[model samples]
Target chain A: MISAYVTLAVLLLGLALWRQTQPDPGHRQIAAGGWRQMRPLLVRIPIALIAGSFLAMLVPRELVASSLGDGSGLQGILLATLLGAVMPGGPMITFPIALALISAGTGTAQMVTLITAWSVLALHRVIAFELPALGWRLTGIRLLACLILAPIAGLLAMLIGAART
Target chain B: MAGQTGGKPARNGPPLLDGSTVFFVLLALGAGLAVLLLRGADAFNTALADGLGLLLLIMPIVVAAVLVGAYVQAMVPREAMERWLGGSSGMRGLLLATAAGSLTPGGPFAAFPLVLALYRSGAAVPVCVTYLTSWSVLGINRALVWELPLLGPEFTLTRLLVSLPLPLIAGLLTRGLLHRFSRTVT
Candidate 1:
């Protein structure tokens, strides 16, 4: 599935690149801009990989399985959301940890809630990016409005999980 | 495409790799070392190899996505984009901003600054909120490329369907609140 996803992304990107290259100005600018942004990956990628690996190894699998496993139910959703918000790092870190929990018997709803919480209220993103760029008022209101989203998502997924059984 | 801001980089008061990154890295290292000491090197090596495999898998996607993102961004410079998003009002602006946020694929560094640019140029509070919320929730590229592959299609769809209403609701509420705040202050 991942391979298919990657292939699709690459194909679409190829089409976009081709379209951009059609115009001479875009051709010149796109290459330079892409390189500039992609350059940091030289450093960030390795660090991220190492961090992700270590985080995966360190995650308390027993606790995760027990707290977010099939039997955990509604309370599990809240716990997962809270964990997502506080868990540090980007997708490189989060996804692996989520995957580990899944393998350890955590429910799909718990993982969904976890990722949703991470996406909307990630402490790392807020500290590293949002606070400085968007500021207190914008961040605060956004957070407030987003308060119920993870739980809502969790509930929906849980309903689905229940229906399937 | 992540760090492509204009002029001074949104002065955010702190350096890019602040204490957060260092602190987290240290934490990972400490935990990993303990795991190694207790669980032995085989478990440690296996975990690292898994991370390496994942990195390899996503490397091509990441580069291609970045290039595509840069092209999209180039096609709509901040000045032009900000003008459009800021001038547009009501549901249309909200929808457009949400679409932009959903379609736009880049890391946090690129997005936060861009939204700030829109806000600084007079985009409505609701539009900005919508944009951020949509970006966080929908993140189409991330979901399709990363989540779908990692978690499978079913899981991805479940989450998306559940999160569908988030941006619009957040936007409407934020707009109303902002209007009330300004009206009262004046």
Candidate 2:
């Protein structure tokens, strides 16, 4: 974690320096914008962490492991995909739950499927944003195009995991 | 078109307290209550401490990520990219859209408008799908800020490697599907 912070700090410094070199002269605005973004994160992260931790405790380890464990295979991946698509909210909400599940012994492949499905096929995002913005034709096309990706990714992850172990 | 773009304010930054935040707070409270009831005060305290400890550990990384995201967004040549996206096609267009999607910062609100704008300006359906797919599956901002810190590097790397080809594949698939659909319709 400390290493992650250091790396990010160096990267942030580099980006800040690059901004300084830019002609826009809106470094102050950028900083303000960052803070504006951070405020919501600040409010949500702790609560999410709490929720995740509590969830981790409440959810039976045996249940998680049995359903989404390494041995669960394609069935687990499919279930995870469904879970991911229906899961509500953004990363702040999703990541914590993911972490909690990880702690509770969810398999790597299943988690990968879940995250990929959530990112690509999130029903809420499609309904709330894509349909309204892009209209049905494009939305339908994109959905049909990308529908198979999450499961494929999950299966591949499982293969890689198998190869590794 | 101008009105369509102008009417929806670009929600680059989320509001401080939105519906999601309220929902999360309620979820946390309910979970906390459940823990307290099911186990006891001891377990409740432990869970709280664990959550707070995790928060403190990741806080600096999160802060750095937020700044990096903001600075990168500020620095992106949006108009130049739009111009590039507007006048490209074929495999090159798909590649460009994929790159743009991966690089695009912020949530759906910021991305969808740009995609819609690009689509309106005659970007190919495959290209648009590629861009949106790339944005959805491989966004650098989300990966850096959320995935790396929360999920750890191994999972992130594995997931990314598996997903790297997805946007292009989706683009190509969309191309084929659209062609067949057009033929059927005609």
Candidate 3:
């Protein structure tokens, strides 16, 4: 995850520098425009990740695993996905957390569910990024989509996990 | 045209690129580096080095998505997007978008940049929503990698069943609400 951030930063910086040195005024304008468009996400995503990391660490991995771990059934999958929606972190923290849960003997299904929820329905991204740019209606719809799909995605992941096992 | 090449109305909106943008890129990079240091430089370095490999893995899909986005942007007009795929009666559009999303190739990370380009190219809200949702949920690649290898065939089938309708559901609900609001105002 950290690597991803570094990668993104370097890419963005390269893009900016390229923009700065553009010979065409219009090209510079375009590059500058892309940069502006990306600003909020660039700023807020890190903050979300930071806050998410702390929150992820605070939650007991054992507790999470137990409640929505490997032994957890379909119901558990649903619960785990719901839990994921509330846990706002990046792939870095979430992936590690999920791996820990799996290692702890949590159901692989639960891991998938958790990841689906985390990636799709994170409240931090919703509040800080989506709502402001896309407007309430759009954000609300996205939230609805995420919440509605999370369980299904979890269920699918679990079923696949189960079959493999 | 979504402020495309020729939308320069002078007062269209704010200028692109600024100090804030630079700061954000710098900050994100700094934070990422910090994360690497905390985790262990050797492990982090190796992982970071693999980022390009990952990028290469999804390059084809990204290129396809970009072409699709550009085509959609060039061809789809605001009136058309609104009429067939806009807010209220845009159910078909939503479904189409969801289907397109389900078919998108590659991993989520690889797809992000291409999707961002789509968003920039005046793609509809529901379409973007569906695309993002379906990209992760029902990618063929995941079926091969994570689903088949780890989860087995039955579970993979079940997972697909569950994920199939998500993009549609998301797209419809989002479009429905937006349409409703738009109607209320007019």
Using TM-score as the measure, the top candidate is 2
Clashes of each: 0, 0, 11
Candidate 1 has which clashing residue pairs, if any?
none
Q: Name the best candidate (by lDDT).
A: 2
Residue-wise C-alpha lDDT for candidate 1, range A95-152, written one tens digit per residue: 6567656766788888889999999899888988999888899898888877778888
TM-score of model 1 vs. true structure: 0.76
Residues A1-165, model 2: lDDT tens digits? 656776688888898787777788477788788777777677777788889899888988998999999889899999999999999889978998999899999999999999999998999999999999999999999999988989988998998998998
Ranking by DockQ: 2, 1, 3
| DockQ of the candidate models in sequence | 0.48, 0.63, 0.13
Can you give the lDDT of residue B78 in candidate 3?
34
Interface RMSD after interface superposition, each candidate: 4.0, 3.7, 11.7
Backbone clashes in model 3: 11
RMSD of 2: 6.2
Tens-digit lDDT string for candidate 1 (B1-186):
345445534335343344545565675677678769988999888877876787776666666655655666666665655665776767888878777787766779768888888888777788888888889989875775456545666788889888887788888878767776678632
Off by over 4 Å in 3: A1-65, A157-165, B1-92, B99-125, B135-162, B175-186
TM-score of chain A of each: 0.70, 0.88, 0.58
CA lDDT for candidate 3: 0.53
TM-score of 2: 0.90
- Model 1: per-residue Cα lDDT at residue A33: 80
lDDT, residue A44, candidate 3:
35
For residues B43-107, write the lDDT of model 3, one tens digit per residue.
45544443334334433332222323322322333344333323332566667665555555433
